[model samples]
Target: MSLSTEHLLGIKYLNKQDIDLIFKTADHFKAVINRPIKKVPSLRDITIANLFFENSTRTKLSFELAEKRLSADVINFSASQSSVKKGETLIDTVNNILAMKVDIVVMRHPNVGAGVFLSKHVDAKIINAGDGTHEHPTQALLDSYSIREKLGSVKGKKIVIVGDVLHSRVALSNIFALQLQGAKVKVCGPTTLIPKHITSLGVEVETNLKKALEWCDVANVLRVQNERMAINYFPSTREYTQLFGINQEILDNLGKKIVIMHPGPINRGVEITSDVADSDQSIILNQVENGVAVRMAVIYLLAQQIKR
Candidate 1:
């Protein structure tokens, strides 16, 4: 089955069937994107408005590229340069944009539930790029898609997400996605960086990086979200690195090959090292590549549901 919802709001709202449909659709787009002529005519008549309230590199570029590849007319709106700087409310701003006949709205806002809030008020279909610390559904979709591409299957695979879970939308979304696909999920990092009651999602928390690495089939490392931290959560970056950093030494210590994954904008020596990120086992780049196709699948599916 395809996505039943009008908005790609969060992974928590999705079931295993939704995820499977996205991956299956992505499989076709993945093949199409790899071809010499990558553009598709499926969304040629559709228009997408990318509204980003937060600064981003990978997600923004990936979405724009995916929309372009799907042959959709795209408009990008950054809050920093928009009328939002003049105290314009989000609904007013988006409604103004939608007045131009945009069919779909993909947004990244710093406020949690911003997408959900927009969906309730807007006529255009909403896609949450990343909404505060709530969730990044498409990122999790591409992440799981990349994992399945690499490790062959997600069912029963052990995956540990390491880093700032307290402020990570990626972590929450990933837990929902991975667990839905029947993967065993774990979180490892400094205790302060992990939120209380995350275990209610059915993942264990391991404070020790070594033990966590030893236990998982894939190590999905996360970067310290310094911008999201209100105050000092840990003593220092150096101390945190000393305790949880993944380097060649750690990789060598692992007796078997374990796939390493990072979302993006990686800290060189903090949660993961340069050597480890560039290692063969690291599917970081593949995740970035798969992001385009996965997003295309999402946009295509959602575009089909649009009345326009």
Candidate 2:
């Protein structure tokens, strides 16, 4: 069995079966990575290109590592160093890269629908590493995979995504992915940072941090995207931290242990206090490890389509 869709452009494009299939594939890869010899010849004959129009550390490295683990030849592209700086078109850059006989293209771009647009114009299989504030499909998949690993299953779990939802591709992807797996989802942040019509996505909005934490089995804290914000969403960083930050004290008061997760480059005391982030309850490290295995599964499965 394989993914229902051709391109992993967004979680919104995937159905429950596709998600399950990816998880099942990831289960195999997870075991492989744990073994003495982590490398696999699964995509030995395939070539992949990693194109980033925006700066990235975690996502870019995860995809590169995944591709290498599967023994796929890899090419890394940065927009800043390329003709894109000279105002070259997206299609021209991709077409030039495709000339190298690449089988798959993993890309992160600053514009929403960049992946979708590329898919239409390019022959190589497309994977959206991230596309502006639209979606990060692999991140959401690994997130749900982590939840399932920690809690046995994603179904019936209450997940509250905390902070900066308006500027987050992760939030949107996670919302769709979690809901698809039958988990209850919520968005928590300042009203300015939270999209006004997010309720239309069937997620409840909770502005109060303690209340949101009290209601959730897992709190996936997001980074405050100061880079994306053109204006102040809140008065000050100190104020935001005081009101919304997750701390050890807040967890202790809850009476029940709730899993803490952060998609990294954490803002430390801003979205989450250091004590809470480094505490035993934080699966932040696990999330990072699972990212590689889950990404390997995605690349492997997508490569299978190329073989077929």
Candidate 3:
């Protein structure tokens, strides 16, 4: 099955078939990346522009490496150093880049619906790296990919997402992707940080960390998004950590092996401890390693739709 859309705006826009196709494609790229010489000429003649309107380290580096592996001509753009700093509109900045003969546009913007908005006006294919509190489609895709790699299949697995759900693009995207692939999902966090309507997405909610950890096949930990919080949701960092933090003690108490995941820029002692993050049960590094292949699958599949 082929992707039904040209742009990957969000997981909300994808179906089970689309996800399966991406996974199947990613499997091949994963093998390719493992070889000594990892470059592929699938997108040899294509040009890609990565426009990040927000600060990023992992996502930016991951996409660039993925594009390079696929042999696509890549141009990187940061909003801080661009015409956006001079009051130029998003559309104008993108159009100027596209005029340079770019074939695909991958962007992470501070505004929600930024990818969707650009897809309406731009001629090139749009990939949503991320958007504000909206969705991070590729991250979710790689996450599922990592889970499948570790556990053999995503269907029927129990997964719990912990921390900052209301403000996390990763949580929203993962919920959609996991549920689509038949994984049971749960969100655990402080009441204020967990959205009231999160259950509408067909996932259970839990405030107790111990219960959530015991009930899941995997616990996907998230960092506290201090940048997104306009006002104090939870009282203090110490209180939040004491209440919800995952450490060696918590894992040892569980008495069974369950996968641990964290989308990075981890808060060492806050959300997760250094020991747990580096433990045998942790697939945190695997998630980062799989990101390139998953992104390559997204870019390669979309490039198939772009006429050379």
Candidate 4:
């Protein structure tokens, strides 16, 4: 259940057994952590810096907690409030930090392949917290953990990931992880939002919200990317709701067996209805909780590979 030191570049880097191993390892780690002594000597004296180019509440804090739980010193950097805003290039800023002899870099950049770029240029081990609609490997890992924990493994589960398919790194990552875990993955959204040939990744594509609703064991809704939406890719919020929103009508169409999930900072009535988000079947909260544990597992496991 252990990964190599090659770096978790993306979900494409991991297979089914590898993911299951992490989940199993996390489960065991949790049990061990419940004891009177919660600390682990595995990563003592390690240094992990969190470099975020974009704002995030869940992912940022999760990574920090993960490092602290392993007894590592944590340094945080933000693009807006840092020297990067003062005419420093990403590379130059990162080099300055790495000069301090940090053991690992956990980065979230708005640039695709930013993590991969840093890994190529740095001595310290790197984990991609996220990088611009390209991939969020840990989000996918935690989502997989959340799904498996809630539904008792993903094998044969008919899971439908709805909304902003093209813009969601979480969707892209989860599609790979979920498919690898033997689930029938489907992505549903309007034409502009859901790209063509996405099924080549081995997931089904659907545009009809109603049909996608009935076919799902889990409806994992996504947030609309207001930050990235330009040229008016969507007609309007009202129209988008009419076509793609996971509202009461969609919820009514979905059977009681279906579990609803949303990555947080939801757009409320647009992507998911508030009622469904707060319902018994909703694992949105669980995703947030599992996110911390999954990240902890990633940090705990990867810290051993840091060569510090």
Candidate 5:
């Protein structure tokens, strides 16, 4: 399965065929990662620009590791250290990077459509590592790959994404992915964190944790962006835990055969309890492992879209 000649600006661009291709590619790489000497020369001589405007951990490291494994030149640009802090515009910075003949730009910005903007201006291909609460294409791909590997198939899975949906690009991207792969999806969070009336996205939205738990095959917990909170979204962390945290009680209540997941740097006893995150039912670590394979597939596939 080959990649099409289109920019991976969002998961919304992926149809069933594209999904299958990336998944297949990821499956190929999973074997590659398991080998003793993990290096792929597929992308030899390619230079990738890691343009991140937002603070990150998992996403950043995953991409760097992916590129290095593929034998690609990796240059990381942080907004705080760059001319963007010295009042340089996004376009000017992108043009400066492009002038160096980059092959692609893996970007994560604080605003929605930041990746789209770079895709429009840069000659290189654009891979959306993340763009605010808008989309995180690689993340969505890794998630889909994780589900496919673990469940054998994502079809007919009742996947529930819980916590901070309104400010979560992961939630938005994952919603598109799960629905595309034929999983039933519902988003659950407190009214303040979940926002109002987003059920129109072909998924149910709920505010009650117990009710959502009763109705899911996989329970996905999201991290709280305490740094990005705008207002008093929730009363307190204690109150949030009482209402939404995934403790041992919630895990037992969900019964067996329920898979748990969190996009990492998990707030441990916060959005999810230690038991659930460390449980046999938890696929959280799989998500991180697959993140590298998925990112490699994304960079390899997206780079092929460019005609040199």
Candidate 6:
């Protein structure tokens, strides 16, 4: 079975079957990556271009690694160093790349709908690495995959996405993906940081961290995006930490082990403490490992649609 949509622009575009297919595909790739000979020749004839209009560490490296693991020829582009600096349009840049016969475009951009826009105009397949504060589909896929790995399944799991709801692409994607797979989701943070229309997506809002933790079987903590904040959403960093940060003390008070997750570049003390992040309950590292396999599955499946 294949994904319903050709381009993975967002989780909102995917159905339950599509998600299941990705997870099933990832299970196979996960085992393949664990083997001594990690490389595969699945896409040896195909070429993929990674276009990053924004800065990334994990997502960028993860995609590059996934592409190489599948034996796809990879081209990496950074907007900061490219002609985008000289005011080149997105289409011109991509059209130029497509001229070189790139089969799939995995892109991360600061603008929302960048992937969707390219998919309409470009000949190649599209994968949205991230698009503004809109969505990060693969990240969400890997996140749900990690949850399933730890908890047996994503169905009926209670998940709380804590911190910076307004600015996080991860939070939005996770909400859509998790709900599609039968998990109940909640957003926990300061009222100002939480989007006003988020509850319309069928997720509840919890302002109190402790109560949110009590209600959730898993907490997917998000970092405080100071760079994305235009104004003071809360009084101060210390205040936000005091109210929303997850520490060992808070986990101990919960009386049950709730799985901890953080999509990386974590603020050590602002969103989660180092001890909690390093604890056995935290699957942050597993999420990173699963990221590679999940990405390989995505690229491999999309590459199947390419007519060689």
Q: Compare the candidates by lDDT and give the number of the best one.
A: 6
In model 4, where do residues sit more than 4 Å from their true spots? 32-38
Q: After superposition, how far is residue 163 of candidate 6 from its true place, in Å?
A: 0.3
* Predicted candidate 6 versus true structure: per-residue lDDT over 9-80, tens digit per residue: 999999999899999999999999999999899999999999998889999999999999999999999998
Q: For each candidate in the order shown, give its overall lDDT on alpha carbons.
A: 0.93, 0.94, 0.94, 0.83, 0.85, 0.95
**How far out, in Å, is residue 233 in model 3?**
0.5
- Write one digit per residue (lDDT tens) for candidate 3, span 1-308: 56998899999999999999999999999999999999998888999999998999889999999999999999999888887877999889999999999999999998899999999998989999999999999999999999999999999999999999988999999999999999999999999999899988898999999999999999999999999988999999999999999999988999898999999889999999999999999999999999999999999999998765
Quote the positional error of residue 133 for candidate 5 in Å: 1.1
Summarize candidate 1's per-residue lDDT along 37-81 as a digit string, tens digits: 999899988989999999999999999999999999999999999
Residue 228 displacement in candidate 5 (angstroms): 2.1
C-alpha lDDT of candidate 1 relative to the true structure: 0.93
Error in Å for residue 268 of model 5 = 1.5
Candidate 5 Cα outliers beyond 4 Å, as residue runs: none
Winner on TM-score (4 vs 6) = 6
Candidate 4 yields a Cα-based lDDT of 0.83
Q: Is candidate 1 or candidate 5 better by lDDT?
A: 1
Which stretches of candidate 6 lie above 4 Å from their native place?
none
lDDT of 2: 0.94
The digit string of per-residue lDDT tens for model 2 on 155-192 reads 99999999999999999999999999999999999999
lDDT of model 2, residue 37: 97
Q: Model 2 residue 202 lDDT?
A: 97
Evaluate residue 133 in candidate 5 and report its C-alpha lDDT on the 0 to 100 scale.
82
Model 2 residue runs over 4 Å out of place are none
